[model samples]
Structure formats: C-alpha cells, structure tokens
Target: MGSLDVIARALWSALLLCVISFSSPLRAQPEPIELWHGRVKADQPFLDKLFKQFTAETGIPVHLRYIIFKNLKVELIGAAFSNAMPDAIIAPADFLGHYKELKLPAIPDSEMPDTIRPRFLKTVELDGKRYGYPFFYGNNLMMFYNKSLVETPATSWKELRVMKPYYDKRNIELITFSYQEMYWLVPVIGAYGGWPLEGKKPMLNTPAVISAFKFYKGLVDEKLVQSDCNLQCSLLKFEQGKAAFLIDGTWSYKRLEESIGDDLGVAVLPYIDGKPMRPMYSSHVLAFPDYESQGEKQTKLDKLRDFIFRKDVQRQFYDEIGQIPTHKELASLVEHTTDPNRKAHFHQLEHARMMPIEPEMSHVWQSLIRGWERYSMHGFSAEESAVYMQKTVEREIERDTQ
Candidate 1:
C-alpha cells in the first residue's frame, strides 16, 4: 500500500491534467475588420493613421483593400455570388440601391450617433432607411480654365459661346475629350429648363430639352470643343496647353498640379441664362454588407462606425485625403491645403448636387451616354436627342419604380 501506490496515483493525476489542458480551445485573438474601398490617392495617410490608432486603442486590427473604380461593381457582384464579400464596403452613392437590392445589410440612422446624423446629406436615405455615410462629394460638370488664357472667366453659357470665336482665333480648342463627348449632359438640359421625364413619363418632345440639345450642337458646330476627347484626354489637352478649359471634378487637383504645374485655375461650372445648372456630384459611402448580419462582427461594426465619424478621424480624413467631411462642424479641418486652387474647391460643396441613388441609375447612365453619342457623333438634331433622352428617362423611372 505505501510509497508505490502513492507515486502511481500522483503520476495518474498529472497525466489527467495534461490531457484536459491539451484538449481545451486556445484563446483566439479577435479577427481584424476588412474594409473594401475604391481607388483613392488621398486616403492612404488618413487610413494608415486611423488603423494605427484603432489597433493601439482597442487591439482590433483593420485591413484595407482598394479596388479599381471601373472594376468595383463587377468585383462586388462576383464577390456576392461567391459569398466572398468583404466585411464593409465604400461604394458610390448611386450604387447603394443596387447593393440594397442585393440584400446587403442596411445601416440604420439610429445606429449612428446623434452627433453625426445632421452632418450627412439627406439624399443618402432611401425608403426611410439610411444606407451609408457620405465620404467624398462634388460635381464634375464645372470647367477649370487657365486664367492666363482667359483673363476673365465666362459667367454663363451664353458668354462661353460668345467667346468661342476669340478662343478659336487663338487656335485653342475650348474643350477636349478622351472619348466622343461629355458624360453628364444633364446639366445642359437643366440649363434649358428641360426635365428629361414628366411625372415618370417621357417628355422628349419638350421645347426646353430641344433647346438644350441645340446649345450643345452649336458648340460642336462652331468647333469650339472637339467631340473626340474624354475625361483623361481632356486633362491631357489642358496639361499640354492644347486646350484652355476642361470639365472635371475636385479630385483632379493632384493630377492637374503635377501636369499643369503653376497654370492651374478653378471655378464653378458656367451658368445657363443666369440660372445655375445643377450637376450630378458623385459620393462614396461606407456600408455594411449582408454577410455581417450577426454576432460579435455586428458589435465590432457599430464601434468601427462610431470611430470613423469621430471628429478627430473626420479631421484626419479631410486634412490628408482632401475629401469634404460629411460632418458640417468638421468642414474646416482641411487647413493644410497648400494650393490656392485646391482651396477654391471647398466653396463649391454647397451647390453640389448628389447623384441619383435609385437602383436603376445604371440604366439611366447607359441611355444618357448613348444619346450623347448620337447627337455628337451622328448628324442627329438636338430635337431628336432630346426626344430620345426623354424616352430613356421615362423608361428608367418606370424600371426603378417597379
């Protein structure tokens, strides 16, 4: 009974303890939150600082994946089909409804802190459910002209047309495009008081739309602007001194700085008949996808959302990235802007109109692009283009409404 039995029993107890410890689950570290975003030159520094701060404070890691702008939609769709969606995505505002239709998780307004709600634009809401938080917002319809070329910028479309002869005489093309024509001709139509659709029906035959079309046709006919260049080409033309003015967004400041150097200038889009034409402004929004609908992940998302909208984070976003803060109070956070031309961009935010957030916006863009091609490429009259656009608009509205 003695020492042998005592030693055997002790050994058995040690063996049992080792088995229990080995079988137990290892303490797992929290998984890092994955964020998918579109290609942005300005966002890197802000995000790097943000991720460092987040990790230091909460021990929660963040991973970022930037997708090419043109490939984003297709990539998202492919991810959704394969059940490989990222935890969160920053997508274009117009594409929100499409994501919603795909059953992505909705970020309710109530989920956001009350302090952050008023800073966001109302257009971000759809069917009373807030989908995403606005990050970057601005119009591309505005033309930037070289002040040295045109001492006084034209105030309205009428003046622009009147000055065409002078510009042409100088052998300077007023505008250049990479493709066949401009993308958003909606502003021109609006300038002429043309509504593409009347109460969800096509109004292609309206007088206002026809007049707007004629205005663009006149510019083409006068050879003031080549119908051949697109956004990229237009920028190149302006940079090379081939053109004096070009229509583009605020995001182009960096590129212009590198290309045009000391000659860059900024101004709002020219008005039409003394009335300012409202142009579509694109925005990026942060959204939670459907796959993250439960458990510890949802709680982490809520915290991350709060972190993103914090004043310090928002300030960092604006200062480093050059994006306008959605928070009205933090609008002045971008004080580090060195270029005077860049500062001029901040003033245009108020007049900027949000792009259509409807699900059928894709269809509308397709139809609009085709209509522009017809008028600019072929000999179609403005009246014919207007009629065609009106029908397209009506069809889009009907498709979305259903």
Candidate 2:
C-alpha cells in the first residue's frame, strides 16, 4: 500500500484497459464503403439482392446514395473538388471521358480477370491506365414494329423504302430520333465503306454521309417518317402505335414489354446493303474516386469489385434488369428463350459496335447529330450539312488536342 506499489498497480490497470479497447469488435470494425449510383428503377432488384449478398459474404457494408443522371456529373464534380467523393460510382461510358480528365482512380485491364476484360467492347482507360470495370453493356438497336399489323419486317433500309406504300396506305409512320439517325446512317455509310469518324477527325462530310442524310431526308420529304421525330417523340409515337417501326436500344425492351405486351415485334436494324453497320454500344462502369488515403480504400474497393463480378450477382443482374452481363462465363446465363423477342436481343449483340472513348468523341457525335437534324428538320442540302459537320468536328478535335 506504499506510494510505489500504488503507482505500479495504476500503470498496469491503464495498460490492460488499452488492450481491451484495441480488441473490441465495435472499435475494430471498418467503415462501410459509400457508393453513389443513378436511381434507375431497372436496377432496384439487383441492388437489393447484391447488397444483401455482399454484406453477408464480405461483412463490408455498402451505403448507397442515388443521384439523378443529369445532376450526377455536377454533384460528383463538386464532391471531387471538395475531396468528398464517394468510394465507388456507377456512371455511363460517356461520362468516363470526363472522369479520365479528372484523373480518377480506376481498375486496369491487367488487374481484372482475362475473361472479363475482353468482353468489354470499349476499353475504360485514362492516361494509358485502365480506370473502370464495365458492368452492364447494351449495344443492340432493334426496330420494334406491331407484328399483327405489319406481316413482314423490313430486312434493309431499301426494303424499308418499299414499305412506304404500306405505310402511306395505312397512314402509319416510322418513328426515329435525329440523334439515333446514326443507326440508320451507319448501314448506309458502311455500304459505301465510310467510317463515322477518322483518326481524331469527324468524317461525316464524305459522300457516304451525304447519301445517308439524303436517304433520311427523302423519307421525311416523301412523308414516310414523322416530321416531329426526336428522342422523346419517337418513343412516344411508337408507344401510342402511331408508328410501325421504332429504332431504340435494348434497354427499352422491359418498358415496351410492360406497355405493349405481346403486340410488339422486334427486328434487328437493317443495313443498307447485305451487311449491317454495328449499333453503338456502351456500358456503366464502377470506378473509385482519387482518395488521399488510398491504401485502406483500395482494400475495400478491391473486395467490392470482386463481389460485383461474381457469377451469382451477374446472373441476378441479367435476370432482373435487362443489363447484359460483362462476365464471359455468365454471358450465356441469360438464356431464357421463353421469350423469342428477348432472345433476338441477345443475338443482336453479335454485330454491335462501341462508341469511341476519345475525349473529343462527344463533339463528334454532337456535330453529326446536328448535321442530321439540319438536313431533316430544316431544308439544308445534304452536301452543305456534311461540310458543316466535318468542319465543326475538326474544330472540336483541334480544341481538345490543344
């Protein structure tokens, strides 16, 4: 009970308390990874299932924050500037170029399994380093027509032209968007052996581009296509049964199924000649933010990445959300041939094309779409529109390069 004995006993008690605190499960547990994603209704079932499965297996909790697609970029940029970015994000391929410019954290091809990397049509890279893992890829653009009304589907754009009599007699129009005019144009451009874009340049000013523009313009000029057709209007026109053939992505399959039910007949978008041009394909990728404390975050991010690509989760994603699986092994897991229309969608992926991932690619797409719009909406000459598009694209490329 002397002063020295009391001091020794007090020191021992303090050390014991420190050890207990260090070993406590509550104190040792890692923080949950924060995930930011778009709140698409199609993804809900998959998210619920995957989150439950992920938490159960890895013991790493995921906190999800949903942001609208339009606002997501702005919010994410603000978060990045403030050093408050999410641990992981799910965004479209178009936005990947912006993330590349910001130098975000990404999982490279070398890091991913060999089977998974090759399935991705577009390489998700930034500064020669891969930055994202692709999850859902939809490249198939099918023409949805009412089978009961139209007995035979058009196999080519030329065949589509022949159906003008049927369309005019029946007063049925083909619905399409100016932006998606690329789908119809691609086949024609390919028939004439033209590329959508040349090496870092837009090539829409070519003879092929002019011809394709004129083809669509002729449809409008002849009153075969609806004059007010744009992205929103086209889909609406199709849903209302005013149009026979609607050019749209595979993502519209579920919505169409729910709305139109068995009345819908799906056909691959036809080529100009015998060969069809590939439909533009892109995917949603998971990427990490550039973190100050990367070491700890990397460990959690790697675990989440692995969990996402697991076979069971990928299968669930395909089944619940019509998102095409990225895992090569799971690609065939979508084989529910019960629905012939859905089965055709899987077949269409064989001839799909991914959009260019270059930084100036958006400008290229915009310029091409503008040219098509001017030719279709206004009375601009095809040659004039093509020249304007090519010049605008060249300017955009030069600006981005500088």
lDDT of 1 by residue, 225-311 (tens): 676677677887788787877877666665676567577787766787787665667666777777455467887777777787788
Score each candidate by Cα lDDT: 0.68, 0.72
- Per-prediction RMSD in angstroms? 5.5, 6.4
Task: Give per-residue CA lDDT, model 2, range 1-402, as digits (tens).
Answer: 699999999999999999998888675576888888874555666686678778888888888888876588778888877878888888876567776444575555566756574647354654565667887677456678877667887878778778878777777775454444565556556556676865455678888778767765676677656555665577777888777888877766776776787888887777756776566667778878774357777887888888788877777766766677788877655655667776767656666666656667778777878888787768899899988998988887787778
Model 2, residue 168: displacement in angstroms?
Answer: 5.1
Measured with C-alpha atoms, the lDDT of residue 304 in candidate 2 is 88
Question: What is residue 397's positional error in candidate 1, in angstroms?
Answer: 5.9
Judging by lDDT against the true structure, name the best candidate. 2
